[model samples]
Target chain A: MNPIRKVLRAGFELIERPFDRLFGPALNPVAQLGALGFFFFWIVAVSGIYLFIFFDTGIERAYQSVEYISRDQWFHAGVMRSFHRYASDLMVVMVLVHLLREFAYDHYRGVRWFSWFTGLPIIWLLYVSGITGYWLVWDKLAQFVALVSSELLDWLPIFGEPIARNFIATGTLTSRFFSLMVFMHVAVPLFLLFIMWVHILRISRPKVNPPRMLALMSLAALLAVSIWKPALSQGPADLARVPNGIGLDWFYLPLYPLTELWGNGSVWAFLTAFSLMIALMPWLPPLRRARAAEVDLEHCNGCARCAEDCPYEAIKMVRRTDDLPFPTEAEVNPSLCVSCGICVGSCPSSTPFRRTEELKTGIDLPEYSLRQLRERVMDVASGLSGPGRVLVLACEHGGAAGRIGDTVVMPCVAMAPPSLIDFILSRDLADGVVVAGCAESACYNRLGVQWTEQRFAAERDPYLRARVPRERIATVWASALAASKAEAEIVEFAARVAAMPPKRLRSPLPVSSTVPTPKALQTERGTT
Target chain B: MKALRWIGQFVVIAALFAGVAALSDWPRYSQIPKDAGVVMLSFVHGADRKGECRRLTPEEIAKLPPNMRRVQDCPRGRRAVYVELDVDGRSAYRADLPPTGIAGDGPSRVYQRFVLPAGRHDVAVRMRDSARADGFDHESRKSVELMPDQMLVIDYRPENGSFIFR
Candidate 1:
């Protein structure tokens, strides 16, 4: 009995050690960011798989496949489409949040600067992925993306040269190379995983996933949203037509607003400055003497553990042959220091060449005022409508319902987030949200209103089925509604939403199947 | 109300542009609309280039020994086979070599073209016995992978066997 007990104990110790090392390592605020990032990646993968099965690449078959998926097999394909679109936005949001949190926390100095530096490319890739996804629809948006990309590239020196000539060589788009673009759109995410791994390597405690419950709920919500309102593909691109109002994604596309304020070249300059200025933040006015890292001379043991663990490789040891306590004294580089506190945590001997909190004494949130800002945002959302059960949209399309309780909120619906969406939905603040976009890719700013639609496409952008089922959220490309089109739509949409049974807020996670059982399949089909 | 009407007019004009886009996309719909019927249209792609559908130029006849040349088919008729040879003269892409009256996975699909007359007809793919005899075999080879649903055009001199009716 004693021997068996000892063996079981040994097995547990072996298992528990790894878990403890992973979870309870050094102090980490940035680990939460990693967890959220992984959560969104999972959403992206699940949605991509759903999208790929239905994506057709032929010139004639592309739009057709989208139509079949949205309208014909909408019950199943719709859910999958929603998952893909919603998860894409969710992942991007998580990534942005993670980057901002790290920046605010001052985790990008010294040895850790490499991770910070490499992260710029990761953000670029994410936007490109979003752009490619938009183009896959072969709608007006795809046409616009093509036009803009061509125009941008045309100004470069290579167009008449071999490189540009080969690229625009009339027949290549119709050749085997076109197939490669399809393959690449599917494969680029695999490369992004490596970039993320390196990004989180500086931290001792890195979370590769979110809490189990949140993951499952997010997946379920995505699936539910997809089912409620299947994604719709506009007809094939028409170069001749002009569309009215289009949806916009404001996060990455905030540049769109600038375009409205400025023309092409100046806007381009603004974007370039925006990225470069952030990159050049460390070179700003030097930190105050107190804010810079300083050594606690009394605790100095010269063990050099901090130097070993530093991610930016910023610490250097000076050799003094004749000095009393010297042979290997440590010095910290102020220019390279990110103040992430890896050195503070790694020191076995209680000697810190620089203090972590001291370096960040003057730190504050990037936003001007958290409390005042929150109140202002809430006010804006609330103030959009005149009264009860208001529908806030970016466009003025859906006011025809005039059902005493219904109203359209804003000029563009893409500005609202799932959180804002949740606040309104939970309080029964609005009866519904009807986002009618211009034809896909028709936004003048080259902003992805459709991409925004895709991101918030989930049944619960804030939380699945928290207030309304996914079906209540929709993306319709409105030219002008015929004489009575806007009125008919408003009345139609409001009545339909009002008619829906209250949403059941079950944990909005996708149900997974390790084994494909018959019962599981039936339950998956909404039988249970 | 008048200002509102003006804004509404602007929106409608934009919408009209969208409607025109929709209208143009109608015939290109993925699924045949309920109102669709057998419309007269050619399956126009790169059929002629893929098929051996080139006219023999007058200079070529003069270059050829006069005794070997015979009055062949019409100069402007579609041929049965198209051979696309690679730059190095190796066999590359071929079209219209399958047995007539059948369409399946093989060398080529059977011609159901209304433009081509229905019958057992002598056809020329890339090169035939006469073209070989006239030393015009160089024009018959093309290098490409045979794909499903490919279209091509072959040109033959003899108009009798060359008229396409599908």
Candidate 2:
């Protein structure tokens, strides 16, 4: 091989032998989140279908159907309603977490700009989906959703059509609006998934699955939730009355707090500006510079691995006409590079390809796994039986799990779907589910904590208009370097959940509603 | 004036009769209820060659060369799947699942249920494939609102070789 070819070949070889040491990379945090998110979606989809079977789309019947499903079919229909609502909340969270992890890790700045740009719209899409669900319930919250949505649209000047008054109109029940929401709920995601394939195509080694335990746990939890809580709605959408403290889904409704702080228009301005800035984020200075990639011609191979491996598409293949002997080679687009080392990690070909300086470059080892490792710690604390198992789910940073006060640890918290969280809580399966993760940026696989907390938050989604306050899900974060902090956080969360009154082990409702145990309902389920 | 009114209605009635004869065997004499509820369904599984559902458009049919109104599902003599409406909810609408279940049972054969209050109703049906969609049969089924607890069905059984509504 020529000198330049030899050099390029060597650069590629360093990636092939990534450090395999540690408790074995059972899961990559990013992959774990994706796997968990997929299961969460199915949870939503299945429960949504169940709710659909009984959903009445009219003024009088819509609320009645929801009531029948929640109050009568509490085990099946009720659980599905809650699961669907909760799972949706979780899915949005996972997506956001994935975005944040990628962003903090500098994965959003480089050639992957296209992927980032395309994905930004998905945030809006998720919001629309959640709002649509609210409307589908046709409850007080839904009425608020419907009114706000229409008021927003009414500001637009597109009503000049001569025959736009057959059914759905601004002042009345519009078949048009319902049709639009239905179309958006399903279609937007389909479009997003299509774009996602394109985004991943630019990168090699895209993970589409989570760990086995994570996947199963998510599915089990979703099923358990759908069965236990079964999502239902509140009363019919009473547009005339605004219910105080109508339970709100805080994940997507984080914007609600903003709305509360700054009334509508200013918030809209904030959002518009924020969105536009994000869409144009790659243009931000200094962020437009390389975070950690440099092309060494001596170590580089012309395989275009960097180009293919970059999640953000930061590298491009260019001709090696200047100084270099090879006719073709690849160059890093410094401005767009996320320096994720995926390209560096995926490379390994024969020397006949060429040679380059082999930096003893090692893959930051993968420590992601999802065993109830925390359960073992719980046993040590004697917390499992004494108070009931406080399930502290901590992230597997590089290889080992972290324990706080002798409790749980795992990979990304997203891996545990709310169903699992609820299952452990409702069945008294575990005393609590304490999720410890790396700070969003430090997560090696990206999006570990985001998913974990999101799924935890999903438990509280008020789909049936029943606000199930999130059960025993908490987050504590630190860098992989700080194992002690990781331990401290998990223990604190478990202690908190375990200390609560045993009667508070009530199935996922807020600590307030003074209604006696739906003993008849609970008995029916136990019998089943 | 009386004679003129009589002549005008007679002419109008004659025109309607001629137009009805020219198009469909059954002509709608009255408009169905405006509030009639229905579920829009793609009952035929993989009915669209793409295995995706599509809304029909007018230009789609305009491209057809008149001779091909009905397209065959396969070259073999197997009876091709065709859309059949189930007016009764699932209890009255029986779809043969066989060993393969809902997936093997095409969407055209599977009947979904739709319930509406007592009033007039106008339902539509159409066929779609990967590349194009067949012209829709708009206002194809019209029914007077059934009294409470009443039932109705629009059957298209090729084996029986006829379309019937009750």
Candidate 3:
């Protein structure tokens, strides 16, 4: 990570930690707020379809029909109307939260800029769809909206006459005008959905909706609100008279008040300038792209483990070119890879026991390959002399773990294979190993913390064997704000390991099973 | 126990929803009074006569396509109307109404509403068409009695050559 982003991330962590502790990880997965936005959009769509059936599109009947739905069909259609309005409002909230969260995480920089750029348009489309929906009701509030919107449109040079003329008199408004409003209300939402789909196009296995339990709770809350306070339309539009005032839904119509203060042209300028600034944020400071991962076909076993574990879907298993023993080999697509290197941990061939000419793995990052990792681990282990000499493996994004005196920092803790821990133990290089990473719900790489935990527990591939003492290992999930807690965890683990009897090593695993030394490989080949 | 905990979480969420619903203060129709008078002002202006084209010259006609040549090909620009209204000698409303369509060729229409006290009052209205800017092309001043909840309309009639109040 760049120095500026590192400082920015630390600042964000300082603010986020207290809130995380208050809300608990499961209840406050702020990282997944974008998925929650999608869930709310689905609710809005379903309820909107229900409301559409009862809507009248005639100029005279539009307001009357909405009133009938709210008053006469109070039980069903009325509740649906409330749901439609509230869910759409909530979608805006979720999108804003998601945008801020990404900015804080520095996820909008470099290769990730595509998602951020596409997201800006979604905000505009959502607002357009929402405003058109208000117009469809044709109430006094709708009349206000039409007047201001027309004034704003008239600010542009393209129109010959002021659009405000359409609503100047009751005789001028026609059913055809109402039809155009209905068409836009429906069309803009469809466009919004399409933009949302494109927003996730680069991500592999994108999580479009939040966890089912969370989704259920959110939906239930919305339903309760819908029943408790049904949505109602304002009095029928009276273009012949000026409206004194109208209730405003602050969530969607926050800028409407600005029109009165700033005038329509200035308000339009403010909104457009704000949107352009947000869209261009990625290039404001500029960031260097991380190196992509490389695949070693000779070592690949066609297990497709890397493909399965990749959060970005940058890796694929294809037919082997040479006469390798495996029929398929792993391949990395350079463009899509963020160089997270979690695939290195997923590959069984990444074991450090090998003594070949060069340490190699099936899939490895160019800057931080398995060979470099092995050397760093051995160097840290060899330097430890005193009792309770512990090696703490930490993720770069997981706090100030790398700043600790005796620690090996991986791009992500998940990028460190389980065998690496066993290798350290067998060599007696460290008295204990402590693994710390990002908070489980807030992994910057999405699945890093979970996959690391799973690998250690033997629930996923490249699992730690039973022989490795679980007692000597401790995993602490920490955010960047919890540096002190992580350090305390490491100290506590060292004490616990010092109390136990020295781990008696069973016979070392056979050479081939472990990472082979070059001489060992040569001798084995000669024997064969 | 897990299910019970889940239920408890949902109850908390429901309480939150109730709080927000209470605080929203959404408006309702029943709040508006039934007895309200509305004064409607609506009119379409006469066609503009200020910028009509002159008869084509021989040289101008000769430059046209063979099939398009004619004695005259005139262009008519729609009138721009200015309207002003006064209630009891206090200026209540004023606007410059442009032609309706994108090309400024459609009917010039104005629809506006003014809510006034339900009582007798003096009303004056004036309008200027495109052909003359020095004075109003039409004007009306009248004394009228308005009943409670009455709807008064002011319209323009080309055939009658006057403003009609109903």
Candidate 4:
């Protein structure tokens, strides 16, 4: 990672840890930025609709109507107006921070480019909708925004007649002007919502709403602030006079002041270049992607577990093309795949008990096959000499990758299935198996740690068998910079494993006949 | 202890909201000075055609295609418009605007604004839209009183045949 992003990521983690402890990891705002944005969007929309009910679109009445809402209906419409404005401000802050967080995590590259690319237009639409919303108040600030925005548009060569002419005098503006502003304020946000949908189209099970308690708490906070300091317009706009000092919403109108400082043309040029650079950020330096997963038809039983478990939604079930008895088979779209090897973990055929000369899963990464992973684990386990004789399956992106002994790093901790853990403990390969992945709710592959936790708890498919003792299994979630914490966790788990009673050895089975039967396959599928 | 943590989290969230509200409207922006007035010169006017029409000879007309003959031939392009404004005997704004459209056959548009002290001032504007180009075809001068923060607009209309000040 770049040094700047590394520092930023660390800073964010520092701030988030306390919140995680207070609100719990599931409800932390840092993990819920996207969902919180949606909550704010709904607040803005609902309050805007209520404000429009009492708003008049006439040029002369527009300012008076807003004043009435702020003064006459202070308790209801006034609070709603404040909610509309402050919620909008909050949304912008959340979105910008969200963008920075994703950039710092390097989530804008590879297959995740679609979300980042689609976000560029949302930024424009957000500003456009916000600027137009301010214009509807018809106050001094609105007049300034109208004239400056018009002047900015007039800077472009495409306009044959300068739009600034419309704001020259009091008689120049018409009722149609307010109507147009209202239309833009409403229409742009509706289009923005569509783009927001497209932003998460590639990810499976995107969270569109925050947790219930978090939402209620955020609402209460917004309400308290709305009542404490109500939003009031800066005075009515007088076209015959120039607008002097006025309150400015720094979130949306920050660029308006730039137009005056650095002439309109320079501002426009800067905006164009900056937007273009942000739009092409994913490929500013193209990524070198890992090889995608491939399917082995002979091992596949037409089970859709891999398709269901894929975080990228890159896999889908299709009609079986082979003579397999099952009705459907998994098909992988190579372009959308991140080659995280998560499908191998979800596949029922991915078990160390399979005794074939070459162990192949239904869908697996070509670079690091399941057979190689098993062999690597066995080799790492054989060299352990301590009393605990621990084997750690660590995620490459997390803190435990190289911090402890007898470690075998996988692309994601979930890439090692529960059956692999059972295989190790049952064969006396290691005294304990510790699965360490990225920080909670911050999985590099989105759901690697989540599914791994569920599978171990026997709540999800391909669960750990009851025979494997739970005391010998431990899991740790930490970021890449938390190496000391990971080491501490390993130390504690190793001590516990070392103190446990010795396991009863089972009769050794012939290696050539360990393939799963039909009934065993059904059990792996969680259908029996 | 957990309750205390929850209270602390709520206070932090409220503080964040208060911070956003504070910046939402603080540090008031002044777009224009209080004791200054603005004058904006804006107009959209088409210039004269670039080339004059010439009467075709009878022989030339006869050689033309049966349905494609005319008495005169004229070019489609128009001349660029030149405009200059002087405030209190100083050049304030000047532009040589090109005609609109790909064929250069449309109106030339311009909009410029200048800020001056709020007091009595003399304003003059000149525009040239013909091929002659050396001197202005239309000119106007006015002496007007401007109050603090007042706006004065200099506009033009083809039918009015001169500059219009409001």
Candidate 5:
């Protein structure tokens, strides 16, 4: 990772911890920026619909209709206008913060580039929707927006006739021009919604709405401010009189002022160059990812667990191409894979109890195979000499890397199957096994920690056996910057493991595990 | 204790939201200084063809095919347009706008704005669009009182007999 990105992620983690503690992970605003953007968009849409009910589109009646909403319908329609304005402003804030967050967290690189690239156009559509929205108000502020925006647009060679001519004087403006503004204010947002959908098209599951409680609280905040200060228009536009000082929505209109400072041509050039740079960011230095996971048809049972557990939806179940008895076989889409290795852990055939000379899983990463992982674990565990003799499986992107003598680094901690933990403890290779991964809900691979927790608790497939001592198995979740905290957790778990009574070691082959007793073989299925 | 923390977080978030929302309109922005006004000159007009039609010579007509024969031949290109503005006897703007299109046969477009002090001032605008380009074909001069933050627009319409000020 870049040093700048590391610092940014550390800063984001520091800011997120307090919010996470207060509101809980599900309701944290910093984590739910994309969802909050949707929430604000809906607020703006609903309120705009209500205001449109009383809005008149006529040239002479447009300003009066809005003024009437502000003065006569001060309580209902008036408040709705304020909601439309404030929520739109908040949407801009959320969109920008969401972009920065994704970039800082390194989510905009590799296979995730589709979402980031699509986001650039969504921004332009949003600004178009907002600027046209201001034009519909037909106030001095609207006039300023119209003239400045038109002049900025005219700088391009695409337009044969300058749109700025329409705003030369009151005589040049027409009712049809007002109609076009109204049409764009509505049409552009509908297109914006379409592009927003495309922004998340590649992800398996995307959060499009904030938590219910957070949404309600946001609504209340907007309403309180609406009552405190309603959105009112500036004096009606008079082309004969130049608009000097006016209240401006800094979120959308800040670019208009830039046109003045930098000149229209320079501003246009800057915007074009800036947008192109952002759009091409993903390929500026493409990510060097490990080889994608490959499927071993002989080991696969068509269970479909890997397909269901894959965070990127890169695995699929297809008809068996070989003479396998199962109806379906797992297939990997290499383009979409991030080489996380969660699929290997999810495979039922990934157990260490199989008396094979060389272990192989149904779906496994080529660079970091299950065989390499099992060998590393056994080697590290057998060398431990202390009383606790704990072996730690740590994620490279998370905490605990190089923190202990008995540690094995994997692409993700979830890559270690629960059966391997049981095998280590039962064979007396180590007195305890600890799996440490990225912080909860903040997994570098998105669902590693969640799946790992569930599998250990026996709530998910390929669960830990019932006979493994619960106290002997421990899990720690911490960010890469919190190495000390993870080390303390390891020490605490080791002490607990040391206090437990020791069990006789099961008979083991040098290259295989002994079979369990009948009672120990019985599975304990967790309630759904 | 958890409930108290929740309340504190919510209050802080709401306060920040309101603070930014207030900035949507508060702290007014001035686009231009109080004592200044703007003058905009904008229009689109096509100049006459660059060359006059000439009767075809006997040998030139004989070389043409029957369907392509014509009594006269004329150039398709149009002349470029030139414009100048004098505010209070000072040259404020001058430009020669070339015709648009691949063959240079389209209209020339212009949109320019300049700032001047708010007071009575003499303004002069001139344009030349014909073959004889040394002198102006159309001209307008006016002495008008401009209020602070007022905008005056200068436009052209041949049908309206030249410059129109608003």
Candidate 6:
């Protein structure tokens, strides 16, 4: 990592650590910032639908109807109005935080760039939709927004004459105008939803919504806010006179003041430039793509385990073309692959019992295969001389600085199959094994830390056998910048292992007993 | 214990929301002010005189595609109207009202407001509808008494060929 990025990451962690400490890991706001944005959107959508029921989209009646909802129905409809406004504002705040978090964590480059690039337009679309929603009230703020927006639009030479004339005075605006504004307020959100969906398309098993308890709490909070301070409109729009000043929603309408300070053209120029820079940020410091995974049809059983475990959805199960004696085979799509190699861990053919010339798995990363990974694990475990001899299977992205001896780095800790851990401890290659990777929620590969945890807990496939003592292994999640924490965890784990008695290993099975016969392997693979 | 902690977090979030809502002190529905006076200036400017195209001949129409042909080759563009207002011998407002709505060419309408003290004052308004640089196509000047919180309206009627005040 470059010095600039390292400093930035350090700064971000410094700011974030306090919140993690205060809120505890599970309730950490920073960890769940992305999902919070989605939760806020739901609140906005629900409240907006409620507001739409009482809304009157006519130039003359728009303000009056909104006033009626605000005053006459203050308890229900009025609160809903406030909820809609505040939730929309909160959504923008959360989206910005989420963006900053992704950048701070350096998750916006290489394969993750798609999510970042798709997110840029969402901010603008959200602003447009939110501004249109305010316009529906036809209040003083709406008048100011419409005027400034029209002035901005007029900056473009596409129109023959200035569009600002529409809001020049009373009676100039018609119901058709209000109708179009309402249409945009409705339609733009649906378009934004499509964009958000596309933003997560590259990710497998995307968590679009936050946890259930968090969602409920968020909704309750929004409701409480709405009831306490109902959303109210400013005085009705009068285009005949210039407004002195209107209360501004800095979240969505930050650019309105800029229009006043600098002319419309300069504001447009600044916004265009800023957006362009953000869109091109992924390439500012170009990152080399990780090696793509490769599949050997000879070993693949068409079980689709790798496809299911892939965090990037890079692997697909296709019909076997050759006479490989398999009905289907997993194929890795190079363009989508991040090469975290979690799929290699998911492959049952990745067992250490293989005595072939090369320790080939059904699917493997070009740079690091399961065979090479096993050899590294063995080398690290055997090399340890002291009594507290510990083998730490660490993620390359995880903040393992090689401070603790006997460390073997995998692309992700999930790339280390449970069998590998079993092989190390059962064979007495190491007194203890410690698995460490990126923070569970903040995993660079999304599901790497999560799947690793599940695998270690014996809750998922390729589970650590019941015979393997749970106390012999430990899983620690830390970011690449948090190497100190990972080192401390390894030291603590080594101490705990040292306190326990020596491992009682079962007699080793013969190669034939553990490894599947060639004919049986092909037949068993066919059923999967 | 875990469930209790989860519930406690939920309570804290709810309390935070209530606290923020109270602290914000947002305007209530019943608090809308009613004493402010509104001055309405509404008018659709007369059609542009410059760049007005003549009607196409029957032979010319026959030569064009069905979608392209129009019975009359009317002017596609309308000239903007210049409007100026003065109060108490001082220029108060000025704007060039464009022809039509945002999407296409249509009658150019303008609405504006000016809040003044409740008293009698001399008001003057002028508009140039066409491309002529000579003078205003229509003009109005008057001393009008305005009551406190009164709604004053200024309108133009092409049929009457004059500005109307109320």
Score residue A69 of candidate 3 by CA lDDT: 87
Tens digits of lDDT, candidate 5, A1-528? 788778788888897777777777668888889999988999998998999999998667899999999999989999999999999999999999888778877888888999999999989999999999999989999889989998888887777788888876877788888888888999999999999999988877677999888898888888888898889999898888788899989898887778888999888888899899889999989988888999999899999999998888889999999997889999999989999899999999998777676777788889888888876776666567768888899998788876756999998888888888888887777888889997775678878898998998999998988888788888988878878889999999999888878866654544334333222222311222
- Superposed by TM-score, candidate 1 places the C-alpha of residue A286 at a distance from the truth, in angstroms, of 5.2
lDDT of 4 by residue, B1-166 (tens): 8778767767888889999999999889987787888888888999889999899999999999989999998888989999999989999888898999899988998887788889999999999999994989999999989888888888998998799988
Error of 4 at B38 (Å): 2.1
Q: Whose TM-score is higher: candidate 2's or candidate 5's?
A: 5
Per-prediction TM-score: 0.39, 0.42, 0.83, 0.92, 0.91, 0.80
- The 10-residue segment of model 1 chain A with minimum total lDDT is A359-368
lDDT of 4 by residue, A1-528 (tens): 788789988987887777777777788888888888888999999999999999999888999999999999979999999999999999999899888888877788899999999988888898998999999999999999999999998887778788888887878789998998899899999999999999999988888899997887788889899999899999999888788788899999999999889999999888899889878989977667888888999999978999989999999999999998989889999999988888999999999888776787899889888988887787677667667878999999888987645899988988987899988887777889999998886788988988999999998888988888888899988888888899899889999888888777552753344443323434655764
lDDT of 6 by residue, A175-288 (tens): 999999888998999899899989989888877777776777787778777776677787988765554446767677777777766877899899999899889999997678
Determine the TM-score of chain B of model 1.
0.26
Which runs of model 6 end up more than 4 angstroms from their true locations? A1-27, A401-404, A507-528, B1-4, B11-166
DockQ of model 2 vs. true complex: 0.01
In order, what DockQ does each candidate have?
0.01, 0.01, 0.19, 0.66, 0.64, 0.15
Runs in model 4 deviating more than 4 A are A499-528, B1-3, B52-74
lDDT for B80 (candidate 4): 92
lDDT for A325 in candidate 1 is 78
> By DockQ, who's the top model here?
4
Structural RMSD, model 4: 5.4
- Model 2 clashing-pair count: 53
Q: What are the clashing pairs of model 4?
A: none
From the highest lDDT down, the ranking of the candidates is: 4, 5, 3, 6, 2, 1
Query: Model 1 reaches what TM-score against the true structure?
Result: 0.39
Question: Each model's C-alpha lDDT?
Answer: 0.44, 0.48, 0.78, 0.87, 0.86, 0.77
Checking candidate 6 for backbone clashes, the offending pairs are A168-B111, A169-B111, A169-B112, A240-B112, A240-B113, A241-B113, A399-A480, B100-B106
